[model samples]
Target: MRKNLRVAAYAICVRDGHILLARSPADDGTPEWVLPGGGMEHGEHPHDTVVREVEEETGYRIEVTALLGVDSSRRTFPGRLLRRPADHHGVRLLYEGRIIGGDLRNEVNGSTDMAAWQDLDALAGLRRIRLVDAGLRLWRERPAEGRVQR
Candidate 1:
């Protein structure tokens, strides 16, 4: 089996009862909505990573106001192409962000195809990655230990 670890940062930006989200293609090639974030670049601070990712995916410059919490998940699956079992662990730092500048525009030549603000109440039917719900939970729960229970 192969083991992998991934660390990323995500922003929970909300205003007027809407949340900022980016649309990306999921593993099965379905369009899935997720928090505006991605894997960190080596030598990049997590704060800087979130700022850069939000701007790249949503075209909105933001300042990370606070670290809301951390969400970690682990899963094992059979590799489709490698013919091996794999373990993947993901850690995401969820931050509260405020949009300071820039315009809303679709990302070009990026992992996410577009960005949009969705109604918080309307999320139930939308196809989304688990990060979306996890980030939102952290934002709302604001646990003292900076972690949310499954």
Candidate 2:
């Protein structure tokens, strides 16, 4: 049995009444918005991963201020796409970060299709960029010290 485990980090960058997010290219290249962060590389901690990913994706230097929550998601891969059965899964660590430096510049050599701030309330009206709602909820209501209730 081949089991794959991945650790990813995300930041809920909030200032004033807006939240910074990057539109992902994975959702059929349609640019779905999401928090500014990505997967942890080898030998890197989740905190450092979020800082690096946020800068890479949003072009803004941020520091992880607090740990919001942790979550796990899994999907079974059908044999049609691969030679054998496998699980596409992730363990996500959500963090609250504060922008310390750097200006908003959409890196031409980046993974995101777009990076911008969206009204916190207006998020519900738009077709969110995935995990944004969950991250925000966790940040707002700091649940226990384990995995989020949801």
Candidate 3:
């Protein structure tokens, strides 16, 4: 099996009972909502990655305040070789962020199509990526180790 590893950062920004979210543009034509974040550039600090990614995806300048936690997950998917599978692992750092400035706008020709603040209570009914739930859990529980086991 082939192996792939991804290290990323994400932010949880909530205000007035609403949570900030970005709509990931899926090639499969399925709508997927996710927190504003993505893979970190090489040699970039996780804190810096969260701030940069949030701005790129949501068009909001964010100030990362707290390290919420890290979440890790692994999955297997079809590989390049016929009938073979690839192992994919993702390590995501979740952080508490506050919008410091910048007007709201959608990312242009990027991974996400739109950005909006959604009602937190209504999130359960929306089609979202797992990172949303993971980020929220870290925000809510705030484990001492700053890591969520999967």
Worst 10 residues of 2 by lDDT: 77-86
For residue 136, model 2's alpha carbon misses the true position, in angstroms, by 0.5
lDDT of 1 by residue, 68-147 (tens): 99999999988787578889999899999999999999899999998999999999999998888888888888899998
Error of 2 at 16 (Å): 0.9
- Measured against the true structure, the TM-scores of the candidates, in listed sequence, are 0.96, 0.89, 0.92
Error of 2 at 76 (Å): 1.4
lDDT of 3 by residue, 16-85 (tens): 9899999985647898899999999999999999999999988899988899988889999876547568
Which candidate do you rate higher for TM-score, 2 or 3? Answer: 3
User: lDDT for each of the candidates?
Assistant: 0.93, 0.84, 0.90
Q: What is the lDDT of residue 118 in candidate 3?
A: 95
Judged by whole-model lDDT over C-alpha atoms, candidate 2 comes out at 0.84
Model 2 lDDT tens row, 1-150 = 346688899999999999998887753566678788888999999999999998988889998899988878887765555567667788899999999999887757677767898899889886665478889888888888745565
Where model 3 places Cα greater than 4 Å from the true spot, the runs are 80-84
Q: How many pairs of residues in model 3 come into backbone collision?
A: 0
Where does model 2 exceed 4 Å of error? Answer: 80-82
